[model samples]
Target: MNVAVGCKVRFLNDVGGGEVIRIIDKRTALVKTFDGFEMPALLSELVVVEPAADELLQKKTVQEKETAEANRKKKPKSEVEYLTDDSPEVADSSGDELSLDIAFVPSNISNLQQSTFDMYLVNDSTYRVFYVLSNVIDDNHTPISSGILQPDTKVLVKRLTPEDVSKLIIMNLQAIYHKNIPYKPFQPEFYDIELDPIKLYKRGNFKRNDFFDIDAYIISIASTKREAFIRHLTDKAIVEAIKQKEKPAPVKEVKKPNIETEEVDLHIHELIDNWKDLSPGEILKIQLARFETALEGGIKSTTTKRMVFIHGVGNGKLKYEITKLLSSKYPKLRYQDASFKEYGFGATMVFLK
Candidate 1:
């Protein structure tokens, strides 16, 4: 009997059983009980429970439940043994091809414009395969479904709302397969599908497929005996890293560029493009603003020991104003006359604190 994940099954010898949560191998599977106990059991020892049987089991009374449990085989617990990968039964296959696809079947095919989707994974091959479907955004992988798919089986993985379908981004799938018996080695398959959210709304894009009855949008990651596409994961980033690794070593003593002096020309003409029509107050304001900016730079700079401010020896108003502001707002800074030979005593030098 072929089994897949999420199949409801019951223990043949035990009184009760649970749904199949994982397929361990061809002959072994992991079943989760109603009480949340997950135990390994052989596929042969567990029988699939139909939907009707589940309803009757739920409605059964305490006495009826006990009677049902008593009717099961009274075999000892020692008789149960889960098959391992090395077991003879784990060997089996679909000949050569192991294909799979991510399908999105519209809920209302007639009205595809406003319909939601029922997302599913279709394993077209005859080999039982394990798959993980996830969305990758901003380098983070979030799982949507992680389970085993029986050969030639399609499982409903998610019910996508219209909003979810609209914001669809890149998705990734990873899979590994096992057979009913030993078969030739097969490599793990991976895919990074860049989904076009707009395609889901286009009625003409949906085409008939073998796995689903409706015209569903399908993304085949693996086909025939090999992968349908290639993955160049972060190749650009890796190339950049290699380029940095191969860079030449720095010089033994790299010479620093000469930084002669830090100077500021607070002349109104240098500060603004069109200032001839401005008032004296506005003109002084612009000059003072330039002075404050230069002062801050001198104070914060590590290498600069001093800064020169060309206030010009016009009416000494600019010089007096600079001194007064420096004394009041910046007590740590000291000011003195700049070089009389170079600036004709027009510039003032401030000793950066």
Candidate 2:
């Protein structure tokens, strides 16, 4: 194979085509093409192909090259995945996972007046309604919309059948009522509503909200509620809240000591003298305290600036606490490890908002 620079070759596999740029070894050659790509190809993979005189084989224009470079420099947009179908699990910062158990109900049950209500079916015999009377209501009933429920309108709810309850659970009807129903709890009250005897014996004591209970009763209603109820007491939310609560507060950057031209030697000697007397821990503590003071000052002063915490490399406890505090308290600010010479491994820099 006499493939040399400028020789055209078609790759044996679907490796595409290129022009030879450098002969690497007896069996390998470097190829550079009009697409601005370079790759190594084995001699067996390349066939000595004749070049076509078409404009497609020409070198890229300066504008095209600039566009290609800009495109290469562009980064993909960041995405946050709140929910996924593959796994019904969500993770928090503390690495805990949570799942949602959702139930749906119909939108058209007319007699159901409460925006939210809890039902307790006792002994599979009695249907009791724990009615939470709120200002929220639907289009048909705007009792609370005028800031008061009409004294004449008596709000009543009926118990649903077993089949209706199953449909509500399957459809996740609570989400619909929560999103669509307009009711605010002014003085919520609980009441019990007994269903017919046949429905009570078949379905045991199942707890559900009024929207879900009513939707289950009116199965003929056709609206679909697509929201899922997120249990607030999950491990993930609790863990995250705990972490945020426990994390350390942000440290503010110190303004470099105002050194006039004549003060350079004095400043140098002061730094040197301080370094000689202070142990790494002492130096770190003093620096951390200074940063804290500066941070408080910045917040109080409403002045935003960069602050550096100078803790020298020994154990990184001070550094860790400083970073944790900044992340937890002032998450909007930017933070990073300090420069190598400034604090070695122990110091951190923070940009305050």
Winning candidate number (lDDT): 1
For residue 349, what is the lDDT in candidate 1?
Answer: 88
lDDT of 2 at 175: 12
Error of 1 at 211 (Å): 1.7
Task: Write down the lDDT of every candidate, Cα atoms only.
Answer: 0.70, 0.39
Instruction: Give the alpha carbon lDDT tens digit for every residue of 255-298 in model 1.
Output: 77434457888777766666665544455665776788668877
TM-score of each: 0.42, 0.20
Clashing pairs in 1: 91-180, 91-181, 91-182, 92-180, 92-181
Q: For every model in order, what is the number of clashing pairs?
A: 5, 22
Candidate 2 stretches with Cα past 4 Å from truth are: 1-290, 302-304
